[model samples]
Target chain A: MRLKCPANFRIVRLPCTGKIDVIHILRAFEKGADGVYVVGCMEGDCHFKSGNFRARKRVEQAAKILDKIGVGGERVKMFNLSSGEGPLFAQYSIEMDKKIKELGPNPVKVALQAKKKAA
Target chain B: MIIASKKPIEEIIQEVKDYKRLLILGCNECVTVCEAGGKKEVEVLASALRMHFIKEGNEKKIDEKTLERQCDHEYLEEIRGIVDNYDAILSLACGVGVQFTAEKYHSTPLIPGVNTCFLGANEQRGMWTERCQACGSCILARTGGICPISRCAKRVMNGPCGGSSKGKCEINKELDCAWQLIVDRLRDLGRLDDYEIVAPIKDWSTERAGGPRKVVREDVQV
Candidate 1:
């Protein structure tokens, strides 16, 4: 049951994945996060009825906005798994870590660093 | 209400690329209801634009503000103090709001962030359907409260035209034929006999053909 996920990741807990908004995802990248992924309750398993579904849509919206703004949408993702799937959760984290590493640092973060250097 | 949709980020960027200080203005009226240009939309857009400019190595000062209503002079006046700070204003309100805001602030360039679609009703979350064309006429009572001028592809008066089949418009299978809806409503009301009355030629002059119509309410004037 004990699995080691990537140490580079940080988790922000929400009462429900549905609580996640597009701005929250965008703000992650704005604050220099290399990648962001949301893990919601399994499809149709959300305690709040359609919370997971709403989360999925918002995640998609955030990804689209990221794509439109020149940041690869692939950097963000949503995964639905039941609460008991701890192993699967770790696996997903590792997969996302690999994907974000491949994509490299978020362009926004790099730009912010450059701006700071110039100042 | 007036329904609108966001302009593509690429087109919006092009419109304000020349400016340094920018204000992404939003309206809390119909645009807000339609989920087009609301306070939330202003934040999202501001974040996107900031990222765009940051990545380009030419970061600009982008600000956000949502007015109670941009179409009114009072709401437009709310920004008067901060108006001079921005080089240009990217208005996320409907076209009417944009025009009204521009009219009040003569010098600042007012750029539209959303394409004003039509007078519409929100069918559901994220779904809007055109309902009125502001044709300067009211015939809903005769048509059983459905507007043919706005719903019908051809705007026929007494219709169920050749293009209508199986309650659908030939122009778009997804669209319900306005006449079919009208006829069904009349029949339901036991007033199908009204369908026999031929409609007279419409007064085109009352519509947009009259050119930029205005109404003056003397009693409402302060």
Candidate 2:
């Protein structure tokens, strides 16, 4: 199965990634994302002192929920990035792409028996 | 918004007992607003499943994903290829979403991740309460926005069922008598005459009972 938007990874800017509500993260997966990660401000670097922390907590919660639904929670993640950290963002996306590659095609696309092989 | 709750983790796991691989899908619409099947809730359920399988000493591969809106076909396309890799789909959406997922993925056995509850509204942060009954009709616009169909235990359209006491539902004292609120509101607004008109009996069958409802808009449909 082909990953949704496999060729393009979107960087949605919010006032803070913490502003990236849990629903937005869930919506991404629903849209057939192979994997999704939330980028937040680095520790103690948030314009809003604890917004990063809030986003991290929310992302973690969303991941856990996904896991329970039999979807691998590992597909959703939270990370801290600083402004002007272009290289860091690139590395993060690359690492994420690699991780998804390892995870292989999303099972949602293939048949159950086929998923077994992919798994 | 509808208020629903997530099913017990064990109950959900049991539903997919035969599956070696599972795909958990969360809904970003109503479920997200209700805090039941959103991303955070999805993670909690995933962890519980993982721990359960771990204890069994049987390895189970589970993948997770959240959808923007489970009721929409466009959002479901995201899972088109990814879903084929999982044995079953556990939907963390309402009943409608679970059905939609099954409809979209005809081959995959779609299971509900949450119990669809009543039509409700958010009372406040982390609080929800039943509101509209959607009784194949609407009276909220006339009743000053409060719904008698939902608040009244018997869905009395005419008035209080004569069981109301102290403005609480006789069916359950804990509940408010919907008609009482309506009467009070009308009285306060000096529109008491609105209460005198007997409402026509609702034709339930014309509503949802006619079978799954559909609408084809010339403006939007090709």
Candidate 3:
């Protein structure tokens, strides 16, 4: 099947969504990702039984941490979809791309760019 | 174990906002089990603080460390060499750990990151409830191993107060009456006759009423 997503769109796969931790999501932002989203198995359908559920909780917690640091929590999100949902994955990519576009470049990235120019 | 919860991020931010270099210290004992002040929590907090400072357009350095146990002086000494490098120490331990850390490092300011809740048992994952008050008294044997001092809201010894109804305490309908539990346990143990003997007034001196307390074992003294 031909996969279609924005050229800039990046996907980081994991053995299971539960393997995705808060630090991974935050590090993406620290390293200048405008946004990060986790695609996990549908609720209760996780092969690991509760991996997706755990991923959702970690996403929510990571968002709160972002909000506490003046970074809008909406930049990160978790979406549930089965492995066969290729079209849905593209749709989520489009949706996230649009949201990130509206939010513009990540402030951390902008700050780094400015620092580079100053030095 | 000692139960605790993290303070609001805003409160922690306010405490360390003026400092450029800060250490986020955690304890691996009770706070770790409670998910309040463990290594994982330290990473989260350090990242949040860094993000906050970045958002404020300020350069800050936040370090993270988790001691084996913060309340013990030996564990605290591990940071003695590096303590002077930071402006302040943010302790994620219980109140005891915070106080001990502060007392040991008198020159550096110590900030508490968690509000020590109580001496309780972990009912389950993410759930804790108070169990012991450390009143320096143990009446569990006479009361069928049910501690009225900690379990009962009123700490009644002779019998349940008039507010007890259908085995529930008056303070909260959901709370089981301590005396009622004692009576039932006594029946199960075939010691219901012990309930007939009324307990006398407890001596508060054994507890905090005698001011700060300590236990010195002369035999163990070096």
Instruction: Choose the strongest candidate by DockQ.
Output: 1
- At residue A5, candidate 2 shows an lDDT of 37
Off by over 4 Å in 1: none
Off by over 4 Å in 2: A1-119
Per-model TM-score, in order, reads 0.97, 0.65, 0.96
User: What's the C-alpha lDDT at position A18 in model 1?
Assistant: 84
The per-residue C-alpha lDDT of model 2 at residue A20 equals 72
Top model number, TM-score: 1
After superposition, which runs of candidate 3 have C-alpha atoms over 4 Å from their true positions? none
Q: Choose 2 or 3, whichever is better by lDDT.
A: 3
lDDT of 3: 0.90
**Where is the poorest 10-residue window by lDDT in model 3 chain A?**
A106-115
lDDT of 1: 0.93
lDDT tens digits by residue: candidate 3, B1-222: 999999989999999999989999999999999999999889888887877777677758899999999889899999999999999999999999999999999999999999999899999988999888899978888999888988999878788889889999999999999999999999999999999998988888988888899999999999
User: Which residue pairs come into collision in candidate 3?
Assistant: none
Models ranked on TM-score: 1, 3, 2
DockQ of each: 0.77, 0.05, 0.63
Q: How high is the CA lDDT of each candidate model? A: 0.93, 0.78, 0.90
The best candidate by lDDT is: 1
